[model samples]
Target: MNITVVGTGYVGLVTGIAFAEVGHEVICLDVDEIKVAKLRQGNTPIYEPGLESYLIRNIEANRLAFTTVPTQAFAEADVIFIAVGTPERKDGSADLSYIEAACRTVAEEIRHSTVVVIKSTVPVGTNECLETMMNTISLHSIHVVSVPEFLREGQALSDTFQADRIVIGAQDAHSSELVRSIYEPFERPIFLTDRRSAELIKYGANAFLATKISFINEIANLCDELGANVDDVASGMGMDQRIGRSFLRAGIGYGGSCFPKDTKALVQIAGDVTHDFKLLKSVIEVNNTQRHRLVAMAKAHFGSLIGLRVAVLGLSFKPNTDDMREAASLVIIDELLESGAHVVAYDPVAQSQAKRILSPTVEYANSVTEAIDQADACLLVTEWDEIVDTPVDVYCKLMKNPVLFDGRNCYSLDEVKQSTLTYYSIGRNDIIHAYT
Candidate 1:
C-alpha cells in the first residue's frame, strides 16, 4: 500500500514509520520545512524510544519518505491518514482546526478514489463531519474512516506494533476492509464499529485511565494522612482480577499529551450535550492539586521557600521522552520559582526542551549529581531511569540540608531508610534522617 500521512508530529511520524516497517510505502507530510528536512536526512525531531531507528531503517529501505509537498504525496497514495494534532481549546473542547486543515488539503490534492483515515484523536462525529466536508469539496469518491491511534509517547513504536486491539470505524464495508488491511500484518484483534463509537472509545479510554490515576492519587493522599503505604494498598487492590493494574501507581498526577487534554475534552463533550460530568470534573481538580503536592511538602518542611536552593531531578512529564506538554515538573518548578526558590533542574533528554518552556531563572544542570550539588533540598518530579537508578545516599552526601521530596515515589522506603537524607514521598510515611 502507498500511504501518505499528514503531519509529522508524534502520531503521524510513528504511524507512517510503523506502516513502512510493515512493508508499505509511506510518505510523511508536514508543513514545517525544517522538520521535514530533518526527517528526510534521517533525523527525528521528537524523542521517542526506538523511533529514530525505525525511521532510519524504513528510509534506508526506500519504503518511507518525508516531504513538505502534500499534493504530490496525497495524489499518489492509496490511503491518506490525517494524523495531525487536535489540541485543547480554552473551553476544554478539542481544537479541531488542524484536522479541518488536513482534510481540506486532502480534498484538494487527492487524485483518485482513496481511503482517508482519521488517525488523529478527534471529538465524536468528527469523522462523519469530515466525510461530508470532503465529499462537498472534491469530485473524487473518498472513503473516510475513523481509526484513532492509541500509541503512548515514549513507547509509541512498541504500542503501535503490539497493541492489544485495533479499532476500525467506517460506514462502508470497503473502507473498513481497507483500514483493516493496513493493520492485518500486525495480526491484532480488530474491532469494527461506527465512526462515532470509535471516536468516543479513544476519549473514553483516556478518560478512564485518567480517572484511575486520579483515584489512586486520592487514595495515596489519604494514605499519607493515615500512615498507610499506597504501594501495599495498590498491590492488594490490583490483585483482584476485575481491577487489573496499569495506571494505579500513586504519583503526583498524570501529565502528558493525552490524559490532560482528553479528560478535559471528555468533560466538555458531556457539557455540550447538557450533561455535567461531575466525577470527571473532580478528577481534573484532583490532578491539578496533585501537581502541587511536592511543593506543599517542601513548604511544610522548611516553612518558607524564599531564597532556598532546590534541586529538581527531572523535567519531562514522564521518562524516556523530551515532551514537556502538561508536565508536572513545569507546574512544580513554576510554583517554586514564584515562591522565591532558586531551582536547579536536570533531565537526560529533556533539558533543551525544558529550557524552552521553563523560566530562564532556572539553572539547568548537566547531570543528577550536578543538579543536586549543594542544594538545600531535592524534588524528584519525573521518574526517569537515570534519576531512579541513582544511589539513594547521593542526596545526603551532596545536599546541604539532605531533604528529599519525591513526587513520583521513585525510591522505596527501604532504600531511603538506609540513607541519612530526610525523605518525603507520596502515600508513604516520612523518613526523617536522625541527624536532620
Candidate 2:
C-alpha cells in the first residue's frame, strides 16, 4: 500500500513511519520546508523512542520519504491520512482550521478516487462535513474516514505497533476495508464503526482517561486532608477489576497534547447540545488546581518567596518527550515567577524547548545536580529518570538549604527518610519537614 500522511507532527510522523516499517511505501507531507529537509536526512523534528532510528532504517530500505510538495505526496497514494493538528479554541472547542486546510489541499492535489482517512483528533460530524466538501469541490470521488490516532508522545512508535485495537470509521465498506488493510499487518484487533462513532471513540477515550487522572488527584487531595496515603488508597481501589490501575497513579495533573485539550472539547461538545457535563468540568477544575498544590506547599513552608532560589527538576509535560503543551511545569513555573522565586529548571531533553516557553528570568541547568546546586529549594515536576534516579541525599549535599517539594512523588519515602533533606510530596505521610 502507498500511504500519504499529511502533517509531520507526532501522530503523522509516527503513523507514516510505522506504516513504512510494515512494508508499505509511505510519504510524509508537511508544510515546513526545513522540517521536511531534516526528515529526509533522517533527522526527526520531534523526540520519540526509536522513531528516528526507524525513520533512518525505513529511508535506507526505500520504503519511506518526506516531502513538502502536496501533489507529489498525493499522486502515488492508495490512501491519504490527514493527521494534522486540530488546535483548541478559546471556547473549549477544537479548531478545525488545520484539517480544513489539509482537506482543501487534498481537494486541489489528488486526481483520482482516494480513501481520505482523518487521523487527527477532530470533533464529531467533522469527517462527514469534510467528505461533503471534498466531493463538491473535487472531480474525484473522495471517501473521508475517521481513524483518529491515540499515540502517547513518549511511547508513540511502540504504541502504534502494539495498540490493543485499531478503529476504522467510514461510510462505505471499500474505504473501511482499505483502511483496515493498512493496520492488519500489525495484527491488532480492528474495530469497524461508522465515522461518527469512531470520532467519538477517540474523544471519549481521552476524556475518560483525563477523568481517571483528575479522580485520582482528588483522592490524593483527600489523602492530604485525612492524613491517609494516596498510594495505598489507589492500590486498594485499583485491585477491583472494574477500576483497573492505569491512570490511578496520582500526580500534579495530566498535561500533554491530548487529555487537557480533549477533555475541554468533550465538555464543550456536551454544552453545545445543551447538556452540561458537570463531572468532566470538575475534572478540569481539579487538574488546574492540582498544579498549584506544590506552590501552596511552598508558600506554607516559606512565608514569602520574594528572593528564593528554587530548582525545578523537570520541564516537559512528561518524560521522554520535549513537548510542553499545557504542561504542569508551565503553570507551576508561572506561579513561581510571579511569586519572585528565581527558578533554575533542568530536563535532559526538554530544556531547549522549555527555554522558549519559560520566563526569561528562569535559568536553565545542564543536569539535576547543576540545577539543584546551591539552590534554596527543589521541586520535582516531571519524573524523568535523570531526576528520580539521582540519590535523594544529593539534594541535602548540594542545596544551600535542602527543601524538596515533590509534585510527582518521584522518590520513595525510605529514600528521603534517610536523608537530612526536607521532603514534601503529594498525598504521602512520609514528608520530612526538617526546615522549621
Candidate 3:
C-alpha cells in the first residue's frame, strides 16, 4: 500500500514508520522544514525509543520517506492519514484548526480514489464535518475514515506493532476494508464502527485512563490520611480478574502529550453538546491537585523552602523519552522557585528541552549526583531508573542535609529507614531523622 502520513509528530511518525516496516511504501509529510530535513537525514525529531532505528532502516530500504510537500506526497497515496496535533483550546476543546488545514490541503491535492484516515484525536462529529468538507472541495470522490491512534510516547513503536486492538470507522464497506488492509499485519481484533464512535474511542480511552490515575491519586490522598499505603491497596485490588492493574499506581498525576489535553477536551466537547461530564471534570481537577501535592510535601519537610537548595531528580513526564509536554516536574519546579528555593534539576534525556522551558530559573545538573550535591533536600519527580537506584549512602556524603522526597514513591520506606537521611514520600508516613 502507498501511504502518506500527514503531520509527523509522535502519532504521525510512528504510524508511518510502522506501516513501512510492515512492507508498505510510506511518505511522512510535515510542514516543519527542519523536522522534515532531520527525518530525511535519518534523524528523529522526537524522542521515542526504537523509533530512530526503525526510521533509519526503513529509509535505507527505500520503503519510507519524509517530505515537506503535502500535495506531492498525497497525490498517488492509497491511504492518507491526518495525524496532526489537536492541542487543547483555552475552553478545553481540541483546537481543530490544524486538522481543518490538513484536510483542505488533502482535498486540493487528492486526485485519485483515496481513503483519508483520521488518526488525530478529535470531537465526535469531526469525521462527518471532514467528509462534508472533502466532498464539497474535491472533484474526485474520496473516502474519509476515522482511525484514532492509541500509542503512548515512550513505547509508541512497541504499542503500534503489538496493538491490543484496532478501531476503524467508515461510512461504507469499501472504505472499511481499505483501512483494514492497511493494518492487516498487526493481526489484532478490529472494531468496525461509525466515524463518531472511532473518534470518541481515542478520547474515551485516554479520559478513562486519566480518571483511573486520578482515582488512585484520590485514594492515595485518603491513604495518607488513614495511615495506609496506596501500593498495597492498588496491588490487592488489582488481584481481582476484573480489575487488572495498568494505571493504578499513585503518583504526581499523568502528564505528556495525551492525557491532560484529551481529558479536558472531552469534557469541553461534552459541555458544548449540553451534557455534563462530571467524572472527567473531577479527573482534571485531581490531576491538577496531584502536581501541587509534591510541593506541599516538600514544604511539610522543610517548613519553609526559602533559601533552600532543592534537587529535582527527573524532568520528563515519564522515563525513556525526552518529550515533556505537560510534565508534573515543571509544576514542582515552579513552586520551588516561587518559594525562593534554588532549584537544581537533572534528567538523562530531557535537560536540553527542559532548559528551553526552565531556562535561567532552574539550574541544570550534569548527573543525578551532581543535582543532589549541596542540596538541602531531593524531590524524585519522574521515576527514572538512574534516580530510583541511587544509594541512600551517596546522599549522606553529597547534601548538606540528607533528605529525600519520593514524589513517585520510587524508594521503599524500609530502605529509607536504613539510611541516615530523612525521607518523605507520597501516601506514607514521613521518615524523620531519629538522631538529628
Candidate 4:
C-alpha cells in the first residue's frame, strides 16, 4: 500500500514508521520544512525508545520517505492518514483547527480516489464530519475511516507492532477492507465498529486508564491517613480476574499528551450532549491536588519550605520520554518555588525539553547524585530507572538533611530502616528524624 501520514508527532511518526516496517511504501508529510529535512536524513524529532532505529532502518530500506509538500505526499498514495494533533481548548474541548487544516490540504492535493484514515484522536462524530467536509471540498471521492491509534509514549514501537486489537470504523465496507489490508501484515485482532464508537473508544480507553490512576491515588491518600500500605491493597485487589493491574500503580497523577487532554475533552464531550460527568470531574480534581501533595508533606515536616534546598528527581511525566506536556514536575516545582524552596531537578532525558517550560529559578543537574548533593530533601517525581534504581544510602549520604519525599513510592521501608534518611512517600508511613 502507498501510504502518506500527516503530522510527525508521536502518533503520526510512529504510525508511518510502523507501516514501513511492515513492508509498506509510506511517505510521512509534515508542514515543517526542517522536520522533513531531518526525517529525510533518518532523524526523528521526538525521543521514543527504538523508534529512531526503526525510522532509520525503514528509510535505509527505501520503504519510508518524508516530505513537506502536500501534493507530492498525497499524489501517489492509496491511503492518507490524518494524524495531526487535536489540542485541548480552554473549554476542555479538542481544538480541531489542525485537523481542519490537514483536511483542506488533503482535499486540495489528492489527485485520485483515496481511503483517508483518521489516526488522530478526536471527538465523536468527527470522522463523519471530516469525511463529508473533504468530499464537499474536492472533486475526487474521499473515503474516511476512523482507525484511532492506541500507542503509548516511550513504548510506541512495541505497542504498534504488538497491539492488543485494532478498531476499524468506516461508513463503507470497501474503505474498511482497504484499511484492514494495511494492517494484515501485523496479524492483530481487529474490531469492526461505527465511526463514532471508534472515536469514543480512543477517549474512553484513556479516560478509564486515567480513572484507575486517580482512583489508586485516592486510595493511596486514604492509606496515608489509615496507616495502610497501598502497595498491598493494590496487589490484593489486582489478584481478582476482573481487576488485573495495569495503571494501578499509585503515584502523583497521570500526565502526558493523552490523559490530561483526553479526560478533559471527554468531560466536555459529555457536556456537549448535556450530560454532567461528575466522576471524571473529581478525577481531574484529585489529580490536580495530588501533584502538589509532596509540597504539603514537606511543609508539615519542616516548619516551612522557605530557604530549603529541594532536589526534584525526574522531570518528565513518565520515564523513557522527553514529554513534559502536563508533567507533575511542572506543578510540583511551581508550588515548591512559590513556597520559597530552592529547587534543583534532574531527568536522564527530559532536562533540556523541560528547560523550555520550567522556571529559570529551578536548577538542572547532570546526574541523580549531582541533584541530591547538598539538598535539604529529595522528591522523587517521575520514577525513571536512573532515579528509582539508585541505592537508599545515596540519599542518606548526599542530602544536607537526609530527608526524602518519594511521590512514586520507589523505595521500600525496609531499605530506609537501615539508613538515617527521613523517607516520606505517598500512602506509606514516613521514616522521620527528631531534629528540625
lDDT by residue (1-436, candidate 2, tens digit) is 9999999998999999999999999999999999999999999899888888999999999999999999899988999998999889999999999999999999988989989999999888999999999888899999999998888889987789899788899999998888898899999989999999999999999989999999999888878877788888999999999999889998899998899999999999988889899998999999999999888889889888889999998889999999999999999999999999999999999888887878889999889999999999888999998888999888899999899998887778877787798888888863555222
Instruction: Give lDDT for model 2.
Output: 0.90
Q: Tell me the spans in candidate 2 whose CA falls farther than 4 Å from its real position.
A: 430-436
Give the runs in model 3 whose Cα sits over 4 Å from its true position: 430-436
Clashes of each: 0, 0, 0, 0
Score candidate 3 by TM-score against the native.
0.97
Residue by residue across 293-368, what tens digits does model 1's lDDT show? 8999899889999999999988888899998999999899999999999999999999999878889999989999
TM for candidate 4 is: 0.98
- Estimate, for each residue in 90-143, the C-alpha lDDT of model 3 and write its tens digit: 988889999999999898888876789999999999998998898789887878
Candidate 2 residue pairs in clash (backbone atoms < 3 Å): none
Better of 3 and 4 by lDDT: 4
Question: Candidates' TM-scores?
Answer: 0.98, 0.98, 0.97, 0.98
Q: Rate the local accuracy (lDDT) of all candidates.
A: 0.90, 0.90, 0.87, 0.90
Which candidate do you rate higher for TM-score, 2 or 3?
2
Residue range 56-80, candidate 4, lDDT tens digits: 8999999999988888898889999
